[model samples]
Target: MKIVQISDTHLTAAGGPTEEGFRLLVRHLDEDVRPDLVVHSGDIQVLDPDDTADRVRSRELLDLISTPLLVVPGNHDVGMPGLNAWAGITVTDARVAAHVAVFGPDHWRHETDEAVLIGIDSELLGSGLQREADQWRWIEDTVADLPVRKPVLLFLHKPLWSATDEPVDHQVDVGPVARDRLLGLLERIDLRSVGCGHLHRYRQVRRDRAIEVWAPATAFLAAGEDSLPDGRQELGYVEYTVEGGEVTAQFRLVPGMPQITTDDVPSIAQAIEAMTALR
Candidate 1:
């Protein structure tokens, strides 16, 4: 199976260069990397978590892609726990339901002859909510039922960590509590790789038998000093192939997409004010 992973497109209803970047990505997918399935790791929209109109516009724009697509939420698409509240948005059940109402499910599973693809809402991991525990059970049960020989590819919105021992930054990656539980779960599963976005840069690391792939953002690059060591602050997506239960990944920079600095985007406060006005 051939899969393309696109993350952090951050397209907004108010059309701008961010939306143009996604348009370029779709064109590239059509003319070049035409894969069997597209897995959007997250951050499908820009700035607003509860904007149903943004979700509606995103759904319409993403529909331009003809390939089968699956998506999971990012902190931007749905509010993340212990985060975003300062901007006047907090993650609520209705907010998550809003995303599902527009984009299908916040998490899903798909099986191919050679591999199993699972997308989970990473925001739920450290939330300490009932849904978080429920998702863990679902993952464990689902993986337990699968054949031991089948490779499993997991997708989420944030990287596991910059390094295995990196300090926990709740905003950047999974926190300690979620990390410990998730790592324990992976130790028991036949995981081929874990793919994530949210950093805006690209970094890949290997943990025991599984590879962790971080696809670059299609919208912009991470600004100064924000990138992890040995990480590339580039603008692009990832393409991978699964054959004989083995997975190989390639980073394909979307040719000619204009690169924008983080300064070009609105601040959290500005975004919140803008979204409030929209409502």
Candidate 2:
């Protein structure tokens, strides 16, 4: 099966170059790839989690996909815990429920002919809430019953671990506390690969014997050390093909995609300060 993965679109309510690029990407997918399924890793909208307008526009863009589609929540989608309201908007149960009301559930499992695809919300991984515990239990149960012959593919908004030796950075990946438990649970399953986004740049890493593929943002250029080695901030998506029990990935760059420079991702302080000044 051919599956196209797109993440971190970061669409805003006001249509602009980013949206145009996404439109062009959709056209390319419809005309060129024509894959069997499309999966959006996360960050469907821009910053403000309460902005229903942004959600509406995001939904519209997603609706443009003619192929089978799946999605999971990102930090931007359900509100990142601890830092959720630091930017003046917290991730209440209502906020997460709203995503389900518009899109489907925040997490799900799909068993394809070749593999088992599991999606989870990265923001909730280390939250220590009842929901987090519930998801953990669900995951354990899911893995136990899965067919051992089929490899499992996991989807989330953040990487399980950036580098094996690097310390955990909650901002960039799953926190250590949750990561340890998650890795333990996953080791029991036949995990083949993991797909995630949030870094806004394409990268591939191997951790815990699973291939981790990071998808680039479709909206803007990532300005940071996480950029491509050649210093070219690429903007594109990832396409995966599962055939004969083997999986392969391809990063497809969108032609003529516009880019802009930013100091870095907006911090909680920056977002809060901007909101206060507006008030």
Candidate 3:
């Protein structure tokens, strides 16, 4: 099966470069690379988790894709799970519910004749919410009930670990506690790959037996002080071809898609300002 993974669209109600970039991506998907399914690895909004209009606008833009779509929540969609959450907007029950109201469930599973696809809400990890516990149970139960030796492909918003050997940063990747728990649970299954997006860059890392694929943002590039440590800062998505319990990923970009930065757009800059002011 051919599956396309897109991440960090960051669509806003106020039309801008990010929106334009997504439009170009949609066109690219519809015309050039038609895949069996499309999965959004999240950050579906510009910055605010409380703004319903932004959520609606994101949904509208995502609806442009004609392929079947699955989405997971990003920090921007439902906030992070720590004291240093951006703009003091931490993940909460209400925020998660709001995201679920627009997009379906924050976590889900899709089964194909050849493989099992699981998408989880990485933002909920370490949040210490009842939902987090519930998700853990669901993950364990789901994996346990799967047929023996079924190849599992996992998807989430944040990377399980940082690209470098540095300690886990809650701001960029999953926390150590949650990561350990997840890794332990995943050991029981035949995990083929883990697909993620949040760094706004494209990268591929091999850990143990699984390949971790990070899809680039469909919106703007990370620049200046916000630049990521490693990976190609480009505008595109990830295309995965899976067959016979094996998968190969290729990064694809659309022609004429501008490689702009967050500072180049007024709407993004204003949104950053508003988020900072909240602190």
User: Top lDDT: which candidate number?
Assistant: 3
Please write out the lDDT profile of model 1 over residues 1-279, one tens digit for every residue: 789999988777887777888988999998888899999999998867777777888889999998989999988887877753325455667778888888888878898888989889988877767777788899788767777777889999977754434444336776667777777776666788999998787777787777899889988776555335667778989999998878988888877888786567665336656665643
lDDT of 2: 0.77
lDDT of each: 0.80, 0.77, 0.88
RMSD of each: 3.1, 3.6, 1.7
lDDT of 3 by residue, 65-113 (tens): 9999999999999999988887888999999999999999999999998
Q: In model 3, which regions exceed 4 Å deviation?
A: 164-170, 224-228
Best by TM-score: 3
After superposition, candidate 2 runs with Cα above 4 Å error: 83-89, 163-170, 226-232, 262-279
lDDT agreement of model 3 with the native? 0.88
Model 1 / residue 247 / CA error / Å:
0.8
Clashing pairs in 1: none
Candidate 2 per-residue C-alpha lDDT over 1-279 given as tens digits, one digit per residue, 9 for 90 to 100: 999889988777777666777898898889888999888999898767778998989999999989989999887788776653334444567778788788798888999889889998877776667777788889889888888779788899887774334433336777678778888888777888899988787877666556789888887775465322332357899998888887777788876666643333344235546864643
Candidate 2: count the clashes: 0
Candidate 2: worst-modelled 10 consecutive residues by lDDT = 260-269
Looking at model 1, report the run of 10 residues with the lowest lDDT sum. 161-170
Q: What TM-score does candidate 2 get on C-alpha atoms? A: 0.88
